[model samples]
Target: MDAGEASVVLEEISYFEAVLRMLCAMLVGIVVGVERGRNHRPAGMRTHMLVALGACVTMVVSNYLFVEFRPLGATPDPARLGAQVVSGVGFLGAGTIMREGLSVKGLTTAASIWAVACLGLAAGAGYYAIALTGAAAVYATLTVFEVVQRKMNVTRHATLALDLECKDLSGVMHDLNRFSVQQNATLSHVQFDETEERGVYHLTAIAVFRGANPQADQAVFLEKLGGNLNVKKLETTQY
Candidate 1:
């Protein structure tokens, strides 16, 4: 074959290899994304897949372009591009985190996004086994570990604020304390405000409950407190 024809053939082969790498990266991303999607996470299949694909493209460009145009004495550093991918992925992860009241959410989703980017880098570097294994491990952690955590009865301390306006402050405090003790929760702080305009007493209590079922206990407490004759403006929070 002519030299020109041979060069064309080599270019075609390089293009095909890049396409293969991109496809592998995208497939790995999709696998990880599917697990997050099943859990109804914010960064689902599409987001992960795109991140992976983008990383793969960056890697391919760095590897091929640098090698082709690098100076005679200068060495090409392929890892530099991959390193940038890690930092870029952080921005995508930050997008998934959300703040709602006192509780910050989407941390897991952010972590998943970061993981998918790494998987993309692996695929781009032609490390198929490593990328696939990492994806599998991440999926297992999200699904199986979450189940184990739910079953394990882990307790976390939190402060709850409750407000009530009642005619008989002493009786209300007694009932509230009794309920807190029944659930193995503690009322660590309490404050009372009285207004002469309506002749009512406002009581705010901060309680700590076991994290395993704080919501359940709080629901029951509210139901019982709702039955009281003079209770009003009742609210609770984890802050």
Candidate 2:
């Protein structure tokens, strides 16, 4: 074959291989993404799939530059490309984490994104089995483990931020103490912030319940507080 024809054939083969790698990465990402989607996580199927595809593209490009464009006697290190993917994905994961009052959400989602990126790297490197296994493990953790955790008596505490406007501090404190006693919750920490508009008291409490019932109790607490004339704006947080 002519040199030009040979070069064209090689380019076509390379393009086909890159596309295959991207498809494999996307499939693995979707496997992980389905689990996140079922849990209503912030970074769902589409987000994970895109991240995996992007990682695969980066890995493929890096591999091409190292293997095909080596200069003189210098050997290119392909592993460095994988390392870069790990660090670069961190920025994307950070965007998923958010602070809502005292509680921060999307941590699990961020971790899942990181996991998906790793899967992409594995797939890009032609380690299909490893990538698939990792994605399966992630799915199990998000599905089975989560259910088991919810069933167990894990002392998962969530913080609630309450902003109350009362006529005076004395009346508000009295009502708060009474409410705590009734709810079987102890006020672990309390802080009062007084402004011109009203007096704001932030209460951090620990409520002991049999199993997963604290969330329901929190809703009831908010409802009761809202009904009271002495209370103002109340916000609840779970981290």
Candidate 3:
């Protein structure tokens, strides 16, 4: 083949390679997203796949622009576009995070999304091994680490909000400690607020519940507190 024909053939091969990279990126995204989807996360399979695909396309386009404009002496910064992808992905990640009362949720989902974007960039850069490895690592973390975390009782602290009708703090504190001990929960801190109407006070307590079945233990504690003649209302918030 002539030189011009040979160049055209090589260019076609390169374009095909780019397409393969994007497909690999999408596959990695799907692998990561499956775990999140099974857990019913806010940003699940489709979101993860799209994020990776978008990042991969952006990277491909960035390189394409450099080659396309090279004859015109146009300089290209490939990393500049990738940097924007990293920062832009944050908005989607942030949307997955949510705060409910004292508890925060969706952190793992947000982290997974960020990781997926990185995987996409890697695939676009033709780092197939790294991208595949990252996908496996992320999936194992979401699945295996979850079991380990629960078994370890890694999380313990929960907040309890109590509204009680009481004449004195001493009586309430005594009963509360008794309830805490029985339920295997430690009362770390307590805040008291008296209502405008006399003989009513609101107590917010931060506590750490040990062992499994924290919700059951919390339920038992609430039941005991409600039985107190001085307690008009009681609720639990996990932090």
Instruction: State which candidate has the highest lDDT.
Output: 3
Q: Report the Cα lDDT for residue 42, model 2.
A: 80
Better structure of 2 and 3 per TM-score: 3
**Candidate 3 displacement at residue 203 in angstroms:** 2.9
- TM-score for all models, in order of appearance: 0.74, 0.70, 0.79
User: Tens digits of per-residue lDDT for model 3 on 114-164?
Assistant: 999989988887788998999999999999998988889767645555444
Q: How accurate is candidate 3 locally (lDDT)?
A: 0.80
As for candidate 2, its clashing pairs are: none
Q: What lDDT would candidate 1 get against the real structure? A: 0.79
Error of 3 at 42 (Å): 0.4
Tell me model 2's lDDT, rounded to 2 decimals.
0.74
Consecutive 10-residue window with the lowest summed lDDT within model 2: 202-211
Superposed by TM-score, candidate 3 places the C-alpha of residue 20 at a distance from the truth, in angstroms, of 1.3
Model 3: per-residue Cα lDDT at residue 105: 94
TM-score leaderboard ranking: 3, 1, 2
User: Which stretches in model 1 have alpha-carbon errors above 4 Å?
Assistant: 1-13, 156-161, 166-179, 187-206, 211-230, 235-239
C-alpha lDDT of all candidate models, in order: 0.79, 0.74, 0.80
Give the alpha carbon lDDT tens digit for every residue of 182-227 in model 2. 6545554466666566455443443332235666666666666667
